[model samples]
Target: MPNILNLQSLLGLAVIVGACWAVSENRRAFPWKLAIGAVLVQAALVLLVFGVPGSAVVLNAITGAVDGLATATRRGTQFIFGYLAGGEQPYVVQNQPALFVFAFEVLPLILVISALSALLWHWKILKWITRGFGLLFQRTMGLGGASALAVAANIFLGMIESPIVIRAYLDKLTRSEVFLMMVVGLATVAGSTMVAYATILGPVLPNAAGHVLVASIVSAPAGILLARIIIPETPGEGGAHADYDSDLKYDSAIDAIVKGTADGLMVVLNISAVLIVFVALVALVNVMLGGFWLFDGPVTVERVLGWLFAPVAWLIGVEWSEAGRAGWLLGVKLTLTEFVAFIELGNIPAGEMSERTRMLMTYAVCGFANIGSVGITVTGLSVLMPERRQMVLDMVWKALFAGFLATLMSAAVVGALPGAVFGT
Candidate 1:
């Protein structure tokens, strides 16, 4: 981690931004102001949260709060899985292995967060925050009111849960708006899952919770900004609309809890299936790649994708020495899932990666932007708003690309800031 903000890094950032612009759905209508503005906002957030003393203190406080929440969440899991869930040891305190057991650990946070999100919405708290953030996004990025609300809500809600906030507006949304919704949904990870990721990476990255939280918040504006640039608003679309009042049709507190738990159950099952399938597929491909070894060693999908994305990682401030390592995570994240990428990142040995590279890569890889997410996004959103099912299918691939680019943009923005290097 060199402290210098050299010419190479500047060029890297420019190339990354240019690549994003080149892939715009309509290059002629690209929104440069929004793109630049969003990057600046993301940079400010990065500086304040990661750089400034006061802001870091506040963010640390929030991270500590989440740690407390995780502790409480662990209580429920401990009741169910006992020793496997890893709270108190059967004998004395010692190190615990990271558990991927669906029922024991990962899925419980989803269930808790889902129910908590419903309760917040039912209590009108989430509505107010969503409206406030929605208005802010609209003003900042020139997004439509409904689209702004949905994207803002996505900061704390799941892809499907967030869209449910704007369910009434889905039918009337323009193609650009629909695409924006899909991209933002795919670009950001859900809040409940953030807790799980933080729980997973907490061992390696101190402040893991804050970084994951910040990624979700900052990626919202970046996703909206990128989606607009990629697909500008059509003439006469509801780009001017800004109503934040959503029809939150929860029967009662108990009903919200029940429905949320049920939704989380279905999502847990889907996630379990996704992980099982992708892990097995990656192993199968690796086995084949292993049979055809190059002079250096056996080559696999990771090496191929890593070489492709190495420049992209370098473009976002990862040092050339560790660019491939960072890029490998990006490749894994995009091709498989962020979950797998995070697990790989967690597995990386201490000191093998510089602190700066690790932090930038964390920002880079923290998203739901993957190929498999395309199908999941379509399935989830279609069920939420069936009228847009065909439109969703049409723009699925484009949205996935937009989502990936948006996360890359987030990484780039954070990289551009002088304050992102740890221990500076």
Candidate 2:
């Protein structure tokens, strides 16, 4: 079948966007022009990268680079962690399917990408790219320069470090603009984290890096649109671009690499700890819940979530048959973290879910919108703008919802994209 955007996808997009609009804070003042334009832009980018021949070639090359980087990361892991890191001359456990060595192989990529991102920033290449995108966002979205720049920085620096890019504008930003930035932060993953996810999902989805990148790009504008709807912009706000300052200056290239590596190490420890505790707690809860029987015997938290959110899964483009499983992954992502969700998605039984479901789930789970994020984003942004703490606290939950919708919007678009993009 030639991959074309069919009626099913168009309805899904409209339903999802309309749902967001329905619950908008000021529905009377919604931004109709921006919403339509953003969706059109998202559709064009999706078709271009996934459908257009010239663009797919470029996307494939980028995905190739990311895949090679993952391989390189494994090599580094082997050199440092030896057989435990999936080296040659491996023992039984070492050679096993990513069971024991999953963290060893995947988590370290955070460190590598962080250092690489820092190096790019130090050379101002990252700055130029982010600022250019910020400019586009500023003009296209009709957003304040500060918020747009921060949104662009989120592509690489993530929700936490991204606020630093617009630290100066935090105080001046109106309530609506602040919430929009928060929504964008939650909708996208940092470049470092994207590498981590790409490493895990590379085998499951074609062009993992490209999909993750596209997910962020598509969701960002959606986040802004959603935010605007939920809480319409106050009169006279988010107009004109502000002078951007990346606030990411490093003393030297080596300095960036070293600092970024150190930051990556901290993140690795953080991820390791979170996973250890979160997984254990989930098991404990499941044990209690497992006592109850469903048709399939003892039920676990995941199964319950699968059933509860199955409709959500289906609406995002998964088939009705696979909705439960996709919803399970979505639940894990929202409750635990996208990291744990992707790890679990990589382990799904082969042929249990269709290829399309797996690909859509990959896009759906590629953000930082969990409950854990609400506090992290609040604290991170608060460090720069303490005065906005009360306001951030007030809007945190709504931001999370907007972020979730934004990512799901991206997933629908990707799922609707013609499979021809992947040579399917």
Candidate 3:
């Protein structure tokens, strides 16, 4: 394993902060105290999850629970799709690699988790927990009420759904507050997609589910830090409307389930469609580039992306020799979706990279920060606050950079910790 107590990670952290400051809206008006507070909060979460005594026990339990949920989802899929969905085969196995179907075995988890998340929300179970975190963000990060609540809720909700938690206050937010909300939304993953990612990454990383959960949780503060650096809050901004009450509602548990299932269906179909098109396009691109040779091999998209982002990979604590592969994955995550990047990550052969590098890359790519998400965010936020649509469009690209840097900062934090914290 690579050295987890890497001093280069400290340099990476400084470079990230400096990069943000270099493009800051108001360089002289930096929120010094808020920046420190955000880093401290992320450090506390990292220690609690990976360093605290008996954290492994708690993490194992969480992982087991998530795995059990996946099992239950598989059972449902098997009933509907029969042998193709991981059920017993009538004939002898011929192609073991082709046995598992992504549509039948994996996508169903989105439906189940979405329904469960909706049910939990109706029970006010998640709402109260979200409120608790909202208050924490407000108090510790000194964010205005609505931004804090939205950031807190983004840990478990989708980018669009999170802002809906503070929908009523969207128009009331200052320019900086609105940008912060957008940054955090892109920096975190939604609960509905969390299990699917865990299932994909389970073979690559231990406690995969727990790591995905912690990635979202820790990225929130990093998002705040980066967003503040890019767009500092104006003096005497609005803070009186720190309400956490959400306008989202359902008539009953059954209604919530139905709505959630419908939403999940859209998500599943969208993912399926995107993957199909993107993968095909990539193949076509590779075919076009097949004639070109570089380093005594055919030049492909992965190689080009690897060369482009290798520095970023090294900056986030990957070894120089492995940085090319790591950079390709990072580039894919930024240009394509994280789902595609993760699928590629899972395809890498065992022993190809150190455990530390795998863990660092996991944190680095675990977010909704991609070119596609930019349109989704702009359209979603525009519908919620039409009056501020122009402002959102203007600042959203900056928010994307902030979100991207936020995940890298999370990876840098993980890299800075001692190897013993993770038992690597």
Candidate 4:
């Protein structure tokens, strides 16, 4: 029998869900039945992708695309590093290896991927895929068309940008619908950032891109589940009925590339800046905590967080020895942001974590679910729908929980699957 009594996992799920419920306006009317059904559906989908052979093949195809991207990124790194392995490696290359690989080589590749994604969207490739996935969510989850589109868009776009697809519907979206949209946005990842994260974790874990891609897809339903739990979809005034207009005219493919590349650059810069400030703050907290003359020595914020989340790490099938390390990563992600946690995870010494733990952590931490994103969601959504600004604020906490749970659900699914399914 599978070891499923991972208390830390269960507790982590509970903490997020409970936080949402505690703060939600409609907490009393949370749709427990619908929430349960959505979780079941997400679980079923995970099992299909990781346990069934045919679904595994399809998943592998998606993973293959990500791996190909990673390989391309590796080649780009080699170009910048001037063949480190082929000749006498420079001292900088030897001591601070992969630094340039991450900053110059891998990060820029995300812009290329973003441009490629825009081209695909312009050509209707991603539209069809998103539509098919949207239909499945609409039928199974019974979400409105706008909600479905938002959720589907998350598979390809970022939290702030995905809502643009349903921009016309933003002002009139029901409270529950808006909440769902926010949840999905936080739950999934933008295609452009996925490549960057893949590059970040790729050096540490094999098949990192594939695992992150799968994790985002698997988290979709989980987002729905937790959203409904915090604010049940009560039958009320119908959501806004608006059509998506893709009428922004670009001169040509090159024009699209230029525009998209500019946009991706801004995003990358914002991400880098936020990460630097937030990490410094965390370090400051650790320093302050270190001054406290506790029982024997000082305990930093990361250590305390690791202790708090260790049980969850264990529940997710991480080996006992590695649970503390994994828990610290989770703590960092939850309190600060995924980017910082991922960077820290990447910096961990090789062999400190087993492959399974590393893979599960990748899935677990792949989301925009931390405290910072709450502000981003509120500010971005409010700008799009000024009238619903209060609703956006109201749903912010729940959306955070939903997003966190979504990632956990993905990790749990991967943890339960056999390693062969992921080609590990």
Candidate 5:
């Protein structure tokens, strides 16, 4: 592992905040109180989940629960698809790793999780949880009810789907509030994707489910902090109270399952299509660049990305020695998608990177902030409120920057904490 007391990460925290300050729209109107509060709230959440007594037990239980759900998902997949989905095969396999196929085994988990999530939403279990967090955000961060609710829902519903909850208030939200929602949306992953990520990283990191979930939760406040810095709120610019009525309604439990399954199908197909195309494109580019060689390696896409983002990796407390690979993952995440980057991270040989670096990279790339997502978010919001399309376009690029930095900020916090906090 890297240094238990990573002092450099403390500097990183300052640098990240300074970078956000440098991009402030209203430098004079800096949200000093919000900045301090957001960071404090994030730290308190981390301590409550990891550092406090009995926290590890709870986290372990979450991990076990996630693993159990994955197992349950496999049973469904296997029953449906037979040996292709990791059921007993008639023929013996020589290679153990090759037995588990991503499309057949991993992607199906999204479908199961999505249906379950929809059911939970219909049952009001997820809503109350979202409301609790929303209220917390409203109280601590001084966010309006609509903005707070949107950010809280973004943790579970994802960027594109999150706006649906606030669709009624989109026109009412101020420019700053919309941008905050966008930044937070981009900075976090959805509940449906959480299990898939955990399954992918399971071999590489222990308690992978807990780590994935914590990364999303931890980054929420970081998103708030950076969004406020980039576009500080003007006085009397937002609705003080939100109705909290959801536009996402279901006729019944079965209706929710059917609708959620349809949504999950689209998600699974999109992911499958994107991965197929993106991975092939990367390979094609690598083949084209295969002849060129840098000082120690070939000038491939990963190497190029590593060169571009190595400094960011270092800033997040990865050692200089492992920063190149870490940077490559970050770049892949930004350019391609987090799914592609995570698959690459899982592909890396064990023991080549330190546990600290692996953990930091996991948190660093745990956001939906990527090139593809920018289009999805802008287009989705535009569809939700056609009148606000221009405004959405105007601030989206900046929100992307803030959102990406938000995830990095979470990694920085992780780095600054003691190694024992993660049981390392």
Candidate 6:
């Protein structure tokens, strides 16, 4: 039997769409028809891609790519860790007391994956795919050309790099269009980071890489729908259709690899630094919260977050029993960053979370949609279009909400799926 109920999923969908509308300054001007169309198209894409037999070929192609990445990462790991790569003896003998040596040992894989993604982009592989997807968004969502391209590119590139595709249009884009770009950028994971996330969650979930990759693709339209609701586009004022005329110029394959390596190094360092600070801050908060001793028991940040967001999780179809835990992780992802949330999720005892709950959480926490991302998007966009700095700042909060709703939409779809389909 199908695990999803049409009415319930539809209601949850309405809540997300309505919430987006309610939060916008120009709520009365929302484009309900376009938003509905976008949602339907997204739903159709997910059903076709995941529900059909012929679609397996396309999925197989994606799986093959993921396997290639996993193989390369493993080989790179082996080169550094040698026979200790698997940590078989330490795990079996119980001699190593250290709980997080593997995290440090595998850190180099982040750089490797980032470099590989850069090479793929330079080779025009990712760009071709993104352009095709961009065209689809343009047709279905009626987005301005530059905005469509940026949203599509976001499926594969980082928040900053995707905007560079629409650099020429940045200054001319309307407030709504610019807000859509920022929201989409925050709503999806970059191709490079997807590989790193796969590695982080792989131990706990089957098909980890594929799920993360799929989540970003599925979230694109959701982002569009939410952005439209948050800041309705004024048809005559928005810029023309997007064109990614900016070719990724590289001298040679070797040159691409060298530059990509440097880019990846910066990303690795950034992730490491952010994680250290965020995790420590969470710990500090927990210590303070523990002192509360409400009801003669210690309260922690996790508990507070769980209480705050459990309703949202429940709205997305998580079981009541598991909603609090799922809510806590979602809150962490939104308030801090997805990287911090994933680390916590990864360390959670497997027995405490069901496969379905964890799967939903995986989709929920898959984006860079956090408080920090709002500033990143504004700064990045402002750099490309100095004249629009004020506009970017004006729409920052709208983009943040849109980005959050986009990820929630993705989780809602995942939650609505039959557990048998995803092997949950």
Model 4, residue pairs in steric clash: 6-315, 8-311, 8-312, 9-312
List model 4 lDDT by residue over 1-424, tens digit each. 3445344444445555566678666767876666667656766765675557676566557667777776675666566566552233555455455445345655666777877777777667777787778777887877777788788888888898788777867766787788888888888888898877777787788656666777788788888877777767777664445343433335677777787788788777877778779889988988878777555758888778888888777766677788888899989998888877888888876677777788888888999999888888888888888888887886688678778877877676566655665565
Quantify how close model 1 is to the true structure by its C-alpha RMSD in Å: 2.6
Model 5 Cα lDDT, one tens digit per residue, 1-424 = 5463377776777888899999899888888898788777877787788888988788889888888888998898899889888798889888877888999777988998899899999999999999999999998888999999999999998798888988878888899999999999999999999989988988888777888888999899999999999999899788546877889889999999999988998899988988899889999999999999988888999899999999888888889888899999999999889999888888887789888898998899999999888988888998898898999999999999999999999999888888888887
Candidate 3: misplaced stretches above 4 Å?
A: 1-5
Q: Which ranges of candidate 4 are over 4 A from the true structure?
A: 4-33, 54-64, 67-101, 239-251, 293-297, 315-321, 417-424
Reference-based lDDT, each prediction: 0.79, 0.82, 0.88, 0.74, 0.89, 0.77
What local lDDT score does residue 68 receive in model 4, on the 0 to 100 scale? 79
Across residues 311-377, which tens digit of lDDT does each residue of candidate 2 receive?
Answer: 8888777777888988989999999999999889977765676777887888788889998888788
- Worst lDDT run of 10 residues, candidate 4, spans 240-249
User: Candidate 6, which segments miss by more than 4 Å at Cα?
Assistant: 1-8, 54-64, 77-106
Error of 6 at 168 (Å): 2.0
lDDT of 1 by residue, 247-325 (tens): 6669899998998788777877877888889888988999988878765878988888888989888877878888887
Q: By TM-score, rank the candidates, best first.
A: 3, 5, 2, 1, 6, 4
3 versus 6: better TM-score goes to: 3
User: What lDDT score is found at residue 74 in candidate 6?
Assistant: 67
Segments in model 2 whose C-alpha atoms lie over 4 Å from true places: 1-5, 90-95, 98-100
How many residue pairs in model 3 have overlapping backbones? 0
TM-score of each: 0.92, 0.94, 0.97, 0.85, 0.97, 0.91
Clashes of each: 1, 2, 0, 4, 0, 3
lDDT of 4: 0.74
- Give one digit per residue, the lDDT tens place, for model 3 in 311-377: 9889888889999999999999998889898888877866887888888888999999998899999
Cα error, residue 130 of model 3, in Å, equals 0.6
Candidate 6 lDDT, tens digit per residue, 1-424? 5544423455567788889878876878878788778767766776676666676676667666766766777677667675465433434545453533544444666677767767877888877887888888887888777878888899988899888777766767777787888888888988877876776777787666767787888888888888888777775888565556754557777887888788778877877777788779888988777668765668888788899999888777788888899899999999879987877787777788887777778888989899878777877777888888888888888788888889888888767666656655
